[model samples]
Target: MPRFGSWLLAVCFFVSGGAFAGTTCPNFFIAGSAPTLDASLLSRTTEVCHTEYVLFASGVTKGPLYSAEHLTAAQIAGANSISRSGSWHQETGIPTADRSQSSDYTNSGYDRGHMTPAGDASTLTSEGETFSMANVVPQLHKLNAGEWEKIENYVRNIATQQGEVYVVTGPAFDPTTIPTIGKDNVAVPAYTWKAVYEPGVGAAAFLCTNADNYTCAVVSVDDVKTMSGVDPFPALSATMKSNPIGLTLP
Candidate 1:
């Protein structure tokens, strides 16, 4: 848990409309290892829309994710960008569903996706922060609102069972440059990537999407050494070692 002072500072900043000072998003250090995140840049006062469980940044949005006070943006740039939301003590900004809208706009064709998935925001406060608009992106409505959301929930449940889980998520764009929707309002992506680490078993999993589709690369804690590509494994510390299992794709 983080110190109470940090929580207080976050709340004050959130309420007072302060902004995050750094261009880089925060990193998650677990088991003596620090991993990077990928997401869009953060923006202030942008219009956020929820079409089920997935939250996306639409009109005139800047940055990757936003909280009440701060904006979360990426650090490294390429096919992917990393962003962080949430902390140790306070569970302030986990994005919620817009129940007022009909499930018609949320379910069926759409994937119950998460702008900031559960494993990524492993901590209570971190998970809460993920709920903010700055942290969300356009996800497959069905996946975002359904099975995908379930996967995130399951990860959280497993984390609680094991102890804690550290997660990192970001999109893998095709051109590397951020893509914009055309007049037709079609959302296109280059690619997407997600990684998860469970300290309880020293297990890890990485998933990648090239054309809005999900594929799982189940590697043992040791096998991670062999994986490489456009988005290589962010680098793990000596203290982190263990293979992950039970991962499913949508």
Candidate 2:
């Protein structure tokens, strides 16, 4: 249990597009991590269990435009003894009550894939917080467990190796008319990408398209923009920008 009001949050997550600042989006980006997009179409913020997960709403879909988080190695290690054990719960961050619900994923075929993984929930509170719907996207089962999971595990490994890393991840919804899950019409992204920067070590990004035998695409930060129309990492220093980790397998 946090010391009453002593649970100080170190990161700030918000939604921006046009003049509306209330759009929900995740704050996975830390202080001065990236530059804000000049033109945002829609943004929304959702709050649940006294915690806020900022998510950007898409003009194309009612669900989150994306879910994000900012985490450190120590912050992730807070609950070292706990195991991965928790159920998916509802999130009220979206404007519509029905939009961000647990049932929205019921039989939707897509897994409620976590952009912010559950491995970080090492404490009672943080563990439960990891279940927030605002932190998830409708992802395929194979992709979620396979390539995406590999990427997440690799980042965790980096956290253990170098100490800390900044991560921002979510879906890249294709502009063409696409399939949506549940009644809320949450658009299914053709691909999903995660942009990571390990301060002293190195940084790189990759994307996993949803499919059976999915092969991921290792690309640059600018390449991510061509897919998702957003700059997750803005104003990067020379090292991280120039030194991207290659997607080499073991």
Best by lDDT: 2
Best candidate, TM-score: 2
TM-scores for all candidates: the values are 0.44, 0.76
Writing each residue's lDDT as its tens digit, candidate 1 over 5-27 gives 33222222112122222312223
Q: What stretches of model 1 exceed 4 Å from their correct place?
A: 1-27, 31-113, 117-128, 176-178, 182-188, 206-250
**lDDT, residue 189, candidate 1:** 37
lDDT of 1 at 99: 16
lDDT of 2 by residue, 36-55 (tens): 44254344433232232234
Q: After superposition, how far is residue 178 of candidate 2 from its true place, in Å?
A: 2.3
